[model samples]
Target: MTKTAIIAGTGVLPGILADRLDETNTPYVIAELEGFAMENPKGRPVERFIVERLALLFDRFDDLGVEQVIFAGAVSRPAIDPERIDPKTATLLPVLLPAFQQGDDALLRAVIALFEDAGFSVVGVDSVAPELVPGEGVLTTAQPSQDDKADADRAAKVVAGIGALDVGQGAVVAQGLCLAIETLPGTAAMLRWVAEVAKTCRANPNGAKGVFFKAPKPGQERRIDLPAIGPDTVVQADAADLAGIVIEAGGVMLLDPEATIAEANSRGLFIWARTP
Candidate 1:
């Protein structure tokens, strides 16, 4: 019975993972990062830590007999405080400081390496909760029109292009016009901005609204920071007046599949898990 540590961050996914661990009666501890609040800790024992003292946290995990670690939920880059950098973390500053400039994928990879180098096996969300990744197909009764499909194709390519540069995991395309790309502000903000733009834009005269596409970055370290959507995403897309949502099959996580699909169906928006 090896113990595992859940490095919980902000969002429902961390809470959902906590629920799964509880149901299985798994031996685990939740480590909440500083700055990002953990959602619904489920009354579980949680330890708060900061990036400046990761080495100290590792020692704590060691004392707790934790052998594996899983990163779950959303986290933005924390503003580092030079005065608080522990001696151990300071030793690695040469390697970490450059990663901070190299984009998120690089930064995450570097962080994962730190955990792995510390002898803790890093596990992916897919490995811990396979149920969150839906199978391929349109999950809604409203099928995507040919035009909608075309828009999805365009959106997919756009997401891939941006992903290659570690730019974003999502893109919104309407009639082949890229409406928005997900950035540091995240998908919710991007969708809201698209909705604002749609009010004054009449670029899509063919009547096909658009598609919201999401996927993991090309060659991304899937063990952390995989793109995800939930019922809230469906509501946001509906607000943006988009035709539907598209995700890369096996590459994206649906936070609450039943509720997400039901929302899409209720709003007449299709959730397509397409193989790419």
Candidate 2:
């Protein structure tokens, strides 16, 4: 039977996408990244190397008849250690230097080329989770007020600008001001920052509450590391006592939409999709 595979980088995309394929009756395999800057579960099948080591991943793909591969997860750019690249990947070093030395975007594009050369078509996580793409409308019981929308707009611009510079794609906003942006510490930490700030705002009585906006970094590769939100985001927002959430329509992925939406509705959090 034809097969598919997931080249998991970080976060929950690898396993989530794999499960989606399974539901479609499509068999799949996962090649988790090893020794990269991100977390990896013990006993997972991971190969330690750079993008070029994908050549070997294709060997495994061929064995499973995996004609398509989805590159998912959250491996940060700085996590790659040059000394860890295997011999085959080492040889491709010269060709990759210009891009690798430049930025993660260029490096990922190079990796895409390697996979293409090996006869496997690379796609995004959206292929398996189309419903995860939010539409233009209120997605929760509550609605974003005009002021909240303004804050979300400002946060979106800031987050997208930061994404363009490869910083990150999420920002917290309240009353047209930015509270925090997702950095090396990750989104959860950033939300916590907003929560802290929200407490101060609430105490002031004249201040406004906060919300989070997650958008794609401008020019970020859609095939890899698309911004994702799930039930955890709602839980986090509730803990932060934030007012609502906004995400770019179709730009970010909802890891588990039904559960996430249900959680947001249950928590009285408003969710909207902004069009830009």
Candidate 3:
């Protein structure tokens, strides 16, 4: 039997994955991380562990017979406490600690390498739920207008530029202006900020809503950590007065397609998926 485990962090992504696994009767363990800085997790039978005790976490997983792992949800980078590291992980700290200075994509790759070196299969969330990958094209009744399409195109280029530097994967372009770029707080926060800006311009005679673009970082390992767009994501974008969302088709995951599309349509918003 293939034993799967979820190295979950904070966010709805963990819960989404958990629900899918449960619906399919897939047995799994949740290796929950400590802290609320990045994500508030939702799952059952979770074994909480700090990054410092990674080796101990492996021991617990081994006891549970967890052979394969999925890194789910967003985990922000924090200053790791070397003193908290178990003696086992400390032995490998020389190989691991350097990742702290690298960008998120590089750090994620290092983490994946750690798991693989342990004889565990590190898989992407899409590997377990391939249906979540969005298809290329407009996914809603209201497609983007020419202006919105232009903004999306600009946003895509901006996101790609930042991505190449391992900066971020999302950007908001409105009224021919780049409103905001996603930062460590993540995409939702960026949308929220954009929403605030849209409110300020609500009375502007020439004001127009915007579009949020998400794509993979340049040269980013796509097997895991691809950008995710879900129902909550649509709601955030809508709140930002974004006309629609532009995602990299085949590069992003739509966690709740039915609900997300329904919500987008209801809000008079659109979800367009384009290829990179």
Candidate 4:
């Protein structure tokens, strides 16, 4: 059996993945980032690593017989300390530094390449937990009005436009008017900003507030960093006074699908796993 190394960041996802791996008796180890700690480690075997010394992590993985790697949860860019950069990581700085100047997609692709070059296969979350990616449909009891559907369509295009520049994975559109685009601050912060804005603005003529749409960037490396939402997202959207939440079916991960749907239903907000 190939042992897998899960590079966990901050969020419930790493714990959720750990739980699934446990249920199947799969051999795995959780490698926690230095600053971005896993929300719930579930008492699994864990190792800590810093980005500046990845060579040491590779060596540790070798000792643990880890042949595959997967990334779970969210991570902010770490400020590198030049003094801590190991000789091996230093050799890759030329590539990495330039990627760091680029968008997140570029940086992640570069990171993935390093692991691949070290002879490990990188896997996507969907491959390990297909159920987390909900299929196309309105998941909540509340349905999207025709206006909401149109807003979703517009939001999808806006997300794609920003994604092409490696900007973000989410957007808010109401009655074909672009309300906001998510940037590095992330979905929760973006939604909070939208809520603040809603306090002063009137609803669209059609009476639909807006749609919060999320999806992975076009041409993004889906093996890691896919857009995700959970119960909290539902609460945030409701607070923003949005009509519904729209996620690209098969692209966005639904953390705790049951709770997310339940929250949306209770808030009378629709959760549409849209097809595209």
Candidate 5:
């Protein structure tokens, strides 16, 4: 019997991967990371301490004879108060602390090392859900206006440059000015911040409200959190009156691609997936 374990990070990716594993008659166990939320507001996710979760995750894998581990979903890097770490996580803290504070890749690489050292083969979600990847084209029915396209192109360059520096994936741009950059608060919060700025800008004589672009890191770990967009993104952009959304082709994951495109079309929001 083929067995696998999904160490869930965040969002719908993990559950989707589990469904795929189920179809193949492979038994899989889910180990949800602490402090990450599912895409669905109504969904309840199992959360546990990192080390405790990893121990149980491996134990389940051992019990089920799981040979493959799909690292699907987003894991937020929170400011860990060393005093609060559990016994299991505390033991790993001395090493994990320095790498984690360095940057996203450094921390993730350490996480992968810890798992691989314990004999788990971690795989990317792309192996199971190719359809989720976007192609190079206008993803939404509403094609970008000339101005929207130019804005998107410019914004993409900005975000991509920021990504190369390991800063963040998303940026808010309007009228050639970058309004905000994504940080620990994440995309939705970034969008909301842009909306607030747009609201304020509405009163100004200049039409300077900005749209958003999300891209991948220069040499991103695909198995980890790839830039993600979905129906909620459309709703947020529409409600905020954002000009458009730009993402890297084959670099970002559109959760429920068809539905997201449909929502974008209905809301008259432009979505561009650009390629090299």
Candidate 6:
């Protein structure tokens, strides 16, 4: 039997992929890289391995007849210790450490290359679960006001330009004032900081505060680490006193899309999937 596995990290993407696999009755396993992956795969084989222990995991997958792999969810470059990994994996660490040190794109490309070098095909989640990609449009009834539209447009250009520098994928543009940009600290922190700043120097109190633009890095590989947001995203935006969010159409992951849209609607925040 041809075998495949979902290499789950930490987030809702893995579960979403798992559900899609189930609908097609596709048999597969879950390779849970330690320190990641939220919940255990309830109905399938779940093998655990530390992220640095690649050699052993590759051997294990080969033994289990696995031929394809899909990576989903979020993971940071953990501090790796040479003493902890098996000698076989240690030798290969030199090939990987640099990518980990680079940025998300380099690291992701390295991961895919590593798996392919191990004789396993690396595929994007879209290949296995196409339903998750959102169609292009404002996802909710709350539309961006003209000012908000201009801000969103500016944010999109700014983020895209910065993305080429491998800095980040999101930015906050409030009243033509570029408030914050995503950094190594990530989006939630970026938004939270914006909220704090807004509290100290508030907006007009009636005019739209700002909007966040998230999208794929210009000329970067897709499939891994597509921008993601959830219901709590609405809460964060509301707390930040922001106008809305704009994501690259078909480039962002909507975790629990229905609930997320509903939350955004209830909060009167615009959650749009626009062309980037």
Candidate number achieving the greatest lDDT relative to the actual structure? 4
Displacement of residue 208 (Cα, Å) in model 3 is 5.8
lDDT of 5 at 13: 75
lDDT of each: 0.88, 0.75, 0.82, 0.89, 0.73, 0.83
Enumerate clash totals for all models, in the order shown: 0, 2, 1, 0, 2, 1
List, residue by residue over 221-248, the lDDT tens digit for candidate 4. 9998988999999999989988899999
Cα deviation in Å at residue 124, candidate 6? Answer: 1.4
Error of 3 at 6 (Å): 0.4
**lDDT tens per residue, model 2, 186-229:** 88888877667645654344555667899887877788777888
Could you give candidate 5's per-residue lDDT for residues 1-276 as a string of tens digits? Answer: 656667777668777776677677877666666676545343534435454335455555677677777777777666666555557655666677788678797777787777776688877777677778878998767776776666677788888788888888988776766777887788888778767764455433456345778888877777777788999988887766776788888888888888898888887788888884
Q: Which stretches of candidate 1 lie over 4 Å from their true place?
A: 199-206
* Residues 13-75 of candidate 3: C-alpha lDDT, one tens digit per residue: 777777888888888887777873224344266778888888888888889898999988767
RMSD of each: 1.5, 3.3, 2.8, 1.5, 3.6, 2.1
Candidate 6: segments with Cα more than 4 A from true spot? 41-45, 199-205
What is candidate 6's local distance difference test score?
Answer: 0.83
Model 5 — which ten-residue stretch has the worst lDDT?
Answer: 40-49
Candidate 1 CA-lDDT value: 0.88
TM-score per candidate, in order?
Answer: 0.95, 0.85, 0.89, 0.96, 0.82, 0.92
Judged by TM-score relative to the true structure, which candidate is superior, 4 or 6? 4
> In model 1, what is the error at residue 265, expressed in angstroms?
1.2
Q: Give one digit per residue, the lDDT tens place, for model 6 in 1-276.
A: 456788888877787888888888887788888788555456555688886689899999988889899888888777887678888888777779888878789988888888899999888777887656686888898998899888888899899888999999999888776888998899899889988875345356566688988888987778687778889878888899888999888888787788999999999999888886
Model 6 steric clash pairs: 9-37
Candidate 6 vs. true structure, TM-score: 0.92
Q: Identify the candidate with maximal TM-score.
A: 4
